[model samples]
Target chain A: MERCRELVRPALVEAVGRLHPWTGEMAAYALGWADTAGNPDPGGSEGKGVRQALTVLGAEAVGADGRDAVPGAVAVELVHTFSLLHDDIMDADTLRRQRPAVWKAYGTGPAVLAGDALLAQAVTVLAEAPNPRAAAAVRHLCRTLNALVSGQAQDLRFEHRPWNGPGAVGPEQYRSMAEHKTGALLGSAIALGAILGGAPDETVTALERAGRHLGLAFQAVDDILGIWGDPAVTGKPTHGDLRQRKKTYPILTALADSGRAAHELAALLDSPQRIDGEAAGRAAALVEEAGGRAATRDEARRHLDTAHRTLRDVPLTRTAAQELDTLFTHLLDRTW
Target chain B: MERCRELVRPALVEAVGRLHPWTGEMAAYALGWADTAGNPDPGGSEGKGVRQALTVLGAEAVGADGRDAVPGAVAVELVHTFSLLHDDIMDADTLRRQRPAVWKAYGTGPAVLAGDALLAQAVTVLAEAPNPRAAAAVRHLCRTLNALVSGQAQDLRFEHRPWNGPGAVGPEQYRSMAEHKTGALLGSAIALGAILGGAPDETVTALERAGRHLGLAFQAVDDILGIWGDPAVTGKPTHGDLRQRKKTYPILTALADSGRAAHELAALLDSPQRIDGEAAGRAAALVEEAGGRAATRDEARRHLDTAHRTLRDVPLTRTAAQELDTLFTHLLDRTW
Candidate 1:
């Protein structure tokens, strides 16, 4: 993953630089490539490059050198950053990667415009790619964007009401939202990589399925961490999702459990004038007592298992399959 | 122009519907095709369709049926509305087309997402345009988006300081900003239409130049109306730009005039408090007194004449050229 990210970093930087000079500067700052002054900033934390890794690995799985997948990798990364930048604004998050968010540091207007510019540049880079499948890649990316935006719109509308409010979301709806928000992009990353590398249709479809399951597993773990992980280890506040009343995996699962503990959890969340730490702690305990935590863990494992099964028969080389198997295992093995 | 707009309305509606069901609703509302309840709103005022007209006219000039240009037309109009949705949030404007802005009515989060979705749909529509130049058309649209975002970023930055503040803007800088903000899309509208309609390379280049000058002229006239138009007729408050302290074409030109009235206008704008209606009136008068109004009028006429001359030799049917000449004259004839 690190090798793939490092290989694409220069091209990604060059692609962003192709934006108008002012937008280029703001995007550089947002991407951790530079400070607000346009000078390089090495200390800023960066994303883990999971999507880019999927792209490269998918290409290699099709017996193509991963270098040809760099453009697809860069395109996915740009789209990822674009969503993050806009999401931070919509969620009113002040911190990202342990620093002030782009909206906080540069103001909301520039952050929004910079995100828009990055999205445009993403399509431009793909269309300019030296491949016959560039147009198809652009179409896939746009479809992914629509899904991501739809999921975000649903998430925001969900915020206006409590978990038990009218038209309440159930576990199924939550799973679908998860797929739209994260799985769509991850799936597209692999599909675009395979298409660009001239992989067969069945191979692309198989990789997309694997990537989606991997995304689901990854997000499920993230939801669990949001509620129960030690702040020291996870770098997130304990019971953060409970305090925010986010309809994450565990919360939705607990609500659907429809038992005494689920009732108590809902009551506690409904009483919120913003949940205090103690109440958040109690809420987390209630969710666990309702069997939500175990169920969520089972769901994550199920997705991971399905991901492995789907990749089992794909026509990848022996070494490529082994690498992909290792990759899925590593992704799903993040600390609970 | 109205005929062209009406002709493309159904296709535009269908194109937006291709977004996710949730986003399609919001985008439909933002585009004024539907109300907040997701039902058609016939009374809603439509866009002037200048960009779409350029596309159809460009196509007609190249001896193609205007139907072949509908996709490019829809693409440009989508991009235009996308900018409006995001810019309304950045500008904090409460009203658009006599209704509450999308951000004001549907909340900022959805407004931003809907705008992003529209932009993606724009590219997707072009990529699916069934033309050999689809990829090239997508590239042009993306490039235009980058320029538009860059111009908006500069516009927002211009808001942070007085006219004479460090990195102060002059008339030349203002012109570049105008070109990027409006000219880029308008120019691309014509260029894309021509390219997709199979116009010769030189004719495409000529139409692009003509479209750019037409955009500058349009903006210059809009600046004049922003200050001095009848409120009932323009549906805007008197001296709206002065109240906002916008460094519009007239203001920049007056500031560069370096006369006593110009100095007084600068001082009035530099006053720490917000400019009231009374002060706005004074500023408007000072701009006119400093020859800014006449200079701006001259500038608009110069661009219009250049546009006319540039299109003179382009190989178009006599009726098409005559139609275009009438359109340019009509655009520049807005009452002050």
Candidate 2:
């Protein structure tokens, strides 16, 4: 992961440097390289670079140098950051990476333009890459963007749906939304790496499938953390998703159960009163009583198993495969 | 132009149809195919399709059928629509095509997602096009997106600068912003059409230059209309830009002159009070007295002449060239 970050950092910086100076500063701030005041961050509070690691590992697994996938890594990271910037506004998320969100630091208008600049830079970087598969990479990125937008639309629409009645969000719907919202980009990262590394179509497809499964596992874990993780560890308040009435995996699973606890939780959620701290605590207990916690954990484990099986089935360089296994385990085995 | 619209309409509709139902509805609304209720608009308050016309004409001028550039035309129109939707949110403009802007009708978050969906679709449409130069076309579109974002950033930044100071926006800066915000896509529309039609690089470059000049001319005329045109004709309130304190061409030109009228106009604009109807009327007279009106007209004519000269020098199909000339004249000669 560190190696991947090193390979991607310079190119990502250069790509963002092409934006208008005002927006470029906002992009840098959003990426955690700079603070709101445009001062360089000595602590280097950048992202975990999981997508970058996936891209680099996918390339190495295909018997190519990790550096060969640097462009893909940078492109995926840019797209991820772009989505974060825009999503902060859409979701009204006040904080990101333990700091005020881009829209909060700058105004909504500037944040929107900054996000746009990053997205454009993502496409431009891919299109200008010297790799022979650059065109296919751009196509894959565009398709991923389409999926991301669709997922966001679904998530927003889910906000207005009934809590438990006719229009209630179901497990299948939640999975579909999560797959589009989270899986598409992860899948594209691996696929882009493999494609740019000259992997066969079958290999790329298999790797992408594995990446999708990993994404589902990741989202399941994130939903768990959203409700119960330590604030210091997660960089978010406990029950944040519940407060927002987000249709996350655990909540949807809890709602799917037919039980007294499920009905009580539904009634609580459907109430006109805001989900205050005490209500959120009670709701969290009710969710657990309805077997939401166990179900969510089981779902995460299942996806992780499937991802492992998929990875095992694919032919990859021996050392790189081991490294990928370690990375997956590190990412999904988080207590927070 | 009608022929170009005919070729592009179905493809454009189909491209937008690929978005999630909720955002697709908003995208349709933004494109003027639907109203606030998501019902189809019988009046079809669609844009003039000038970019689409330029694209098809560019193809024809390079000896290809207009139909050959449908993908390029559709891509440009989608990109243009995307910009309008986002720009309305950034500018807080409530109206588009005599209807509520997408953000006004669907909320800011939905509008942002809808704009994003259209942008993704634009790239996807170009990438999936059957044209041999589709890859080049995608690259051109991405570069144009970068320019558009930069232009928007510059425009937003201009709003914060002092009206008259070292950091004040100059005519050169305005021209650069206008070229990026308006000319980049227009130039790309023509360039993509030519490239997709397999025109030589030199011809594509020449055609793009002509398109840029036309874009500048178009923007100058729009600036004139923004300040002086009838609301019934322009589909906007009189002095709409002035009311917003927008650094438009006329206002900037008027402020640049060394004269009593210029100083008076500057003082009026510098005041904290909002420019109401009467003040806008007085400011209009001051602009004309300061030579801004004449200078702006002269600027438009100069760009138009340059565009015409570029077109005359280019080697093009005779009938197609004549058709393009007519299209340019018709577009630039608008009274509104």
Candidate 3:
């Protein structure tokens, strides 16, 4: 996967430059660099680029040399960027990757527009691709973004209206939300790669299923790391999700499976980042005590198993598929 | 234009249905319908399909039967929907065409997703349009959205941080912002029609220029109405833009050129949506007193003249082009 990024980075940056040109410099800045005033800055965009990695790996695994996959990679990454930009605004977060979030540094306006620009750029690049496969990939990319937003909207609604009431929301609600928020994009990323590579329909579906579970496991792991992992490694504050009162899998589990401790933890919820450190710690402790942490970890492993299982069913090149499988498993190893 | 709507409405409805199917039902309400939440009540989405009309008109003026312009019709409308969705959040607007705005009803998260969904659907629709020219139209569509957002970001910034401290924005700033915010998309709409119809590159450029001026004229007329139009005709309260403290051409002129009245208005300048009714009337009076309203009207006339000149420069089928020219003039002929 790391090797995949080295292959994709230069193209990614170039495509990004075209995505938001100088006249729209504020949008470019809002995307990943610069402050609201459009001053250039480094370190604004930093993610694993896992979706892009999937695109390259899928294309290569199917013998496309990844040239055809460039559009797929760019389209997938752009969609992800769109989500991140808008999500930051939607969630009202003040930070991303330890820097001022695009919305926070630039503004809600540019931050939102940057996301739109990226999405629009994705379509442009995909449409201009010489291959017929590009059209299918673009269509898939659009649908993926559409579904992801639906999932995100549901997640947002859960916070205010909840599934039932205060202390409501069960595992199914969390599952659906996570599926849309994380799984849909991941599935689309892999599927697009297959589309670019012209993989058989059955194989493409299998790869999508594989990515979907990986995304779910991947999200559960992220949820755990958001609470229990080392902040130095995760690059996010300890219990950041907890403090936000995010209805994450672990929190939802404790609230559903445990009684008294769940009530006590629920009592501590506040307006996300506005919550005090003490309440955050107390909430984290209660999650562990209620066995929610162990349950979430177990669920993540199960999802990973399901992901690997789906890969075995696909008709793929042995050597290429093996590399992709390896990449898939490593996605959640979390030890860096 | 009514004929255009007859063909495009079903598809637009379906495109919007993709907008956060779960939570975005609220946004659906804001677009023109009501939902079961007993909120997000009905309004109107009943605009003449001017964008697609231009596309079709462009096709007819050339030779293509307008089929190539269909995707662009949807694309332009989707961009409009996306802009409205975000503007509701940025401006903290409460209603759209007389119903609760998407953000007001759905919350920012779902509202944002609704916009995203529309963009994706628009892209997907363009991808299916069966011609490379349609694909090029897709490119035009995306570029327009990017520019629109840039202008929107600058507009928001103007309210919070003025470009030149304590003074009116220069005419160039207004033109720049207006071009990006208004002209870009409309220009794309016109250019797309020409391109889709296989017009010569020269003709496309000419039509794009015509559209740009038409766009500016359209916006100026809108701004004029925003200040002085009857509420019933415009479907908004008179001077609602003033109440929002939007720095339109008329107000900026008065503030830049007038004396005592400008001082009084400037005191309420930084505030948004805080001034209404008599204050709104007073603001209008100041613009008129300082002759700014007359100047703005003249500027709008100049834009219309430029549009007419460009239209005259282009090759056009006599009847179709003549009708289009008439439509062009009639856009600014409202009583307001």
lDDT (Cα, tens digit) per residue for candidate 1, span A1-336: 788788888889899878878788878777877887778888676778888888888888898888878899999999999999999998988877766888898888778888998898888888889988888888778888888887787777677656785577878888888888988888888888888888988888998888888888888998999898878777678898898788888888888886899999888877747797898889999999998899899989998898899889788877767877888899877678
The number of the candidate with the highest lDDT is 2
Q: Which residue pairs collide, candidate 1?
A: none
How high is the lDDT of residue B26 in model 1? 73
Q: DockQ: which candidate is best?
A: 2
Cα lDDT tens digits for candidate 2, A59-169: 999999887898899999999999999999999999888888999989898888888888989988998899889888888888899999999888888888887877899
User: Residue A269, candidate 2: how far off, in angstroms?
Assistant: 0.9
The digit string of per-residue lDDT tens for model 3 on B95-123 reads: 77766777776667667777777777777
- The residue-by-residue lDDT of candidate 2 on B1-336, one tens digit each, is 777898889998899888899888988888888877889997549888999999999999999988889999999999999999999999888988888888888889888888899998999999989877999999889889999999998888888888887877888889999999998888888888898899999999999998898899999999999998889899888987787778988889899998999999989999999999999889989998998788889888999888888989989999988988898788898883
Residue lDDT tens for model 3, A1-336: 677777777766776776435324644554454645666667666577789888877777666677678778877877787778788888887877777777786666566767777777777777677887766676677677777877887787777654235557788778888888899888887887888899877777888888888889998998898888798876777888886677888887876754678777766663334655787888899888777898899989999999889988777767767887888877888851
Per-prediction TM-score, please? 0.96, 0.98, 0.82
Q: What's the true lDDT of residue A190 in model 1?
A: 85
**CA RMSD of each candidate after superposition:** 1.9, 1.2, 4.8
**Taking the candidates in order, what DockQ does each have?**
0.71, 0.88, 0.46
When summed lDDT is taken over every stretch of 10 residues in candidate 1 chain B, the lowest stretch is B159-168
lDDT of 1 by residue, B1-336 (tens): 888788788889888878777678877777777788888888567767888988888888888888888899999999999999999988999988877889887887778888998998888889889998888788878778878887887777777656774567878878888898988888888888888888877888899899999989888999999888888878889999899888888988898777899899989988797888888899999999998899888888888899899889687867767878888888778795
Error of 3 at A80 (Å): 2.0
